[model samples]
Target chain A: MALPSVSRRLRHPFPFAILAIALSLSTGVASAKLRVVASTPDVADMARQIGGDRVSVVTIANPRQDPHKVPVRPSFATRLHRADALVVQGLGLEHAFIPALIEGARNGNILPGAPGYIDASLYVKPLQVPSSQNRSQGELHPLGNPHFNLDPVQGKRMARAIAEGLERVDPSGADDYREGLERFTTLLDEKIEEWARLAEPLRGVKVVSYHNDLIYLANRYGLLQVGTIEIKPGIQPTPGHLENLLRLMKRENVKIIIREISYDPGVARSLAERTGARVVPLAVMAGGLGPEGYVDSIQANLEALVGAVAESGSP
Target chain B: MSFRFHVGRESRRGGAALALILAAGSPLPVGAADSDATTLHEQLEATQREAERTRDEVAELKRHVADLEAAARSADATPTTTARIAPVNADNPAVSFVVDTALDVSTQSSWQSIGYPDGWNFTLKNGELFISAPIDPFLRGYASINGTSDEGFDVEEAAIITTSLPWGLTLKGGRFFADVGRLPHWHDEALPFVDRPPSIDRMIGGESGSEGLEASWLMPIDLFIEVTGGLYDAVGSENLETLNDNGFFGRRSFQELNFLGRIHGYVDLSDTFNAELGGSWTGIPRDEERSLWALDVTLRHQPGTQSSYQGLDLGAEWMWNSQRFTERDDGGAIMSRIRRRRQGGYAYVEAFFARRFSVGARFDYSESPEGAADRARTASAFVTWKPSEFQRVRFQFDNSWGDQQTNQRFTIQWTAFIGSHSHGFAQR
Candidate 1:
């Protein structure tokens, strides 16, 4: 993907300089490659899926890893330094470090005015914005929830956003990006039905999750909302709260606990043990995930969730 | 924006001990929240603020190193000046374009419309032009020209990182628009769910950004340690006063952005347990308001801490802050109400179970010497599910009781990331 042919256009007045090396050696000869960096494996995969060979990617966080905890190592800075553009999961999802990292890297290509930065939340529908906007309560994303990376329909739009950001950074690769998007969507459309079929049994099934994070997925698969493992959205349940939740789960007759692999299974596992329910491991993103890309990663989770449910015998 | 710690004494304690268990993983960021918000945001903000400073400190150290190196070696001794490479072929028909430009138009039609959240017609919400080209391995930049209700056409960030120096040093100068909390950059905006960590309101509701000069260096420690520090116009008096109230600092009394510095360090042990320790101090603005200086340490255990606990990320963040809030003549913090000191310490245990699932419950106590428990000790939890890669749906609910008071909030969020397919990997 390092099409170093971009050097043909410039006659550097300075023989030895940093910018010269950047232009003559690294950037492409005919077209500067879309140097894209995605926050998570899933997002990275999606970019690659639609970006094809026209863009060079340096994925930051892995799929299997907890993105919230991913460190901003020197390598990450190096990745940011070289990037012509960055494609990130918007919605404040990577709210932890990506913003600061981008600022520190100080690459002019991505400042607000540049086309080197892509925020994927613009096109997605916002779900749980606070009914009231008041600091008296706590910090809130006035724009809405910052998590928009898990919905398939939104996923398609995200791809389009990435493609647009890429085009701005590397306009010559427009055709390639277009073709990549077409192929990516073609595969995505096919995969959706297959995923639905695999998860057919889960449709209309009452289920409980360790966290309410997977609402998009559950809704997509037609999983009914039962309850939660935590007492609040961020605060974990104390023993007393857990005891009460256990009582509620038993009363509600919740049969399965759908938890993501990145979460602490201790509570969910305990609940499953107490209620004779099954705990299923769900994959979150693409990188750190089983497959090579976003679609494959989701498919993997779909299959895994279905497999966990089918074996649990929840009809 | 996710929070981790709650406020009050009768909150969930010893959760750090649970960190060793398979259930201790939390998906929320450190101390980016407050009692009024979900516990996740408080913990995230507290956790990240200090670490971010340390990184800055390291950067400042590296800048010193580079400057020292230059001084040690005379300009004449240098064989040849560094190269100034021109950009790649600007007219390559097949590849010259290396940026994406798009106009994002969004309109909201709300029901209930509390506070008239409805009727706010969506305009051309944002216009972005992103470029990751230049092909320089040691340089990068990011920016966004936005038209949100706050400030129109604001430059989010416009800086550069040049790693062509020794000891991994880099230079950065321009506008700064980075938020403090968990979740990287604005990616939180693309979270699978709709509701953002409450910290967003606190961070952005005020003035937009701090402009200045920043320098950094990647340390050569046993592990990965980075130092960064800057001399910027501190947070203005308009919202966050990052200067002293003495009214006699740096031509202050009317200056924006203050003099602040920070340093950060991190280590990854065995791919499962990771530790990041950092500290930072900022000069408050010139006003009657107090200043802030904070220090924090964060540790995370992964893989179950590596186990069906799938990917368990358990983090315990402890922060000690010397943050001084201002009280107006009427003893109010804001113009309309009372103001007081919000100093002291905060700590929390954060956990993220799955990629799409995260929850943080924390106990934070802040007293103004004569104020009530001021800190709201509450329990909060969030369920996030990403049906696909581009969209996230989140259900956020909290059971918070602070100062003998109880308040509960339930929110659902759906976030979508859309790409402008019309523009591909093409740029000028």
Candidate 2:
């Protein structure tokens, strides 16, 4: 079968011309909106708060999906290709997929350690930093737990980082970003106090979580974490571990269990039946419960915790 | 004064009196001598105490110096132990090894034709060692070596890809699996079934990879579309004798080199469902000029609200080949041309009902390569259990019918990976 030569194939100009024209038209009009690609929806929401209308935000991980297992799709690379800045939750939270996406995107400005790259975790104090880097500890992040966005205080810090990153990318819009950040922070401050007051009754409450993701929230509200359903970070609980956890919960009089919406609730429910604990499925990020903004999701999480503790009785 | 007088009386009183008499030339006053002797004795006592204190200070300083020396030695030893605990090799590339083993049981007396023996044969099919690293700011390199019981060892894929190419273009050079169809690009261990679909195996000769340079362009569009083209010396494995150095083609010309082209497009119907369509073409020149064309489609549905493992995947691939052979007379002159055309396809549907368990079925059909009147057909069902991301076990049952022969085979395959191997999306 004699196929046409490469020169003859190249001579056909109609499709090539159409493709070139389409690409030019699509990219020709340079909008002033800063193209911001965030690692997760919560970070995207924070970027939106800081950037307002001055930025266009694209989130890599869906709100309802597990952040640890975000799929690396070609669309992510496409979005990152045109981005002026990239915001990440960063202390290895996006380790599995973000690096590959950045590599695929081939955008030098948004690579790690570059000016347009922002690590939101940098502004906030990390939690659960292990003393030893041991594989037996399961999938532990070497830097620390990367889920500090659960704490509203850290959310404000993340907003500030996003603002700084936007300023670096689009210096002309720096004033707008700063003003937006101030307004968001003021609102966050009020919510934090209100959330603290609402959570006063549950202070020092003994609780068990399905994973170690709730440490920041627990620390914020003074909830004493007695145990976890999973044996380690990212490791499923063995029967022996579950048995020990059940005994510890019973002994400690733990009556509240917090679990992320992404995790299966069957184990939590089984433990609840055994120990009379109320299982509360909370959103790990901004979108787990629904399509919520950052502040709304944190508020929803606070409400879920308070209600579960109240129903389960005081510590 | 009285103590001095007492000392002089007890010890060398005679000598002291003699010296006093010689100096004074007369007996001096006892009170003056006693007072002078007392002052001298007190000065001597103070000097002895000072010397003793200085000796004690020197001993303490020596002990501290010894402690510091010991601490310095300990500090020197600490890193070696710490390194054993957490070894650091900044230049080492991310490495992973995957072992794929299978147990096969067949009703036929010998399955050796396909590299498996009948009646509960345990085969160490392949152990693949993969290494990948960023070579520099502009390029990244990756290599995979597969060691098998039969083939010993072979460089399955070794390629360097350009990272910072302009216009969303990526260039890859070296040996790699050509992106001809969905299944060919995937390693056998990453495949959904225990083995390659029968039709793909028959049509493309198992895995269609070659040593070549491939350039891919990601079209700057709202949707995902990638166009790729490459040129290779040969289209298949080392065993593809028809395309390799066999006397059938005599001296091959540069024009006879194999060429491959493919275009893949992806679209998301919704947050939960997405579909991909791809087409590929390969031209191979031999005594009989041959060209193969393939089309593949895949649909996946995984709700964002649900676990990733709980999803549905459906896929299909169609392949057609055209071969033209020029017949020669006794004088080595071409007499007539014979043309043969063959087509084959396979379709599969898989559903994951739980996080760890999945069930799938595939149907394969192909026209006989020998131009037999009857077509070859096979049906297979497989159940897979993935305990974690690192390990998977699958049990598959196959029944094939062709050439008026029916064969039944059962296989249990286990595949596990260790270390860092980021292949982006999970195996479909």
Best by DockQ: 2
Question: Candidate 2: what lDDT?
Answer: 0.79
Top candidate (lDDT): 2
lDDT of 1 by residue, B1-428 (tens): 11222211112322322232323243435443223244544554554555465557658777998998887786657646587567686632221111212122122332111111333233222334333333265555544433444335544445554634544566766655321222212322432222222222222222224566767665432233455556665443223233333464435443233444445555566555666555554444434332344455666665432242333343232223333444456654464433444443334454555544565543333333334434444345556664433345556554444443444555555544443111110000
Cα lDDT of model 2 by residue, A1-315, tens digit? 344544443344433335545765786676678889989888999899888999988888888777787766766777787788999998999887898788767777897888889888878888889888755677789899998998898988888888888898899998999999999999999999999998887789998988788778878889898888888877778799999999999999999888778777788999999999899888877978765899889888888888888887868
Error of 2 at B346 (Å): 1.6
lDDT of each: 0.53, 0.79
Backbone steric clashes in candidate 2, count: 0
Task: State how far residue A302 of model 2 sits from its true place (Å).
Answer: 1.0
**Residue A103 Cα positional deviation in candidate 1, in Å, after optimal superposition:** 2.1
Q: Where does model 1 exceed 4 Å of error?
A: A1-32, A133-142, A145-147, A287-289, B1-428
lDDT of 2 by residue, B351-401 (tens): 987666899999988775554355678799999987666778999998877
* lDDT of candidate 1 at residue B314, scale 0 to 100: 38
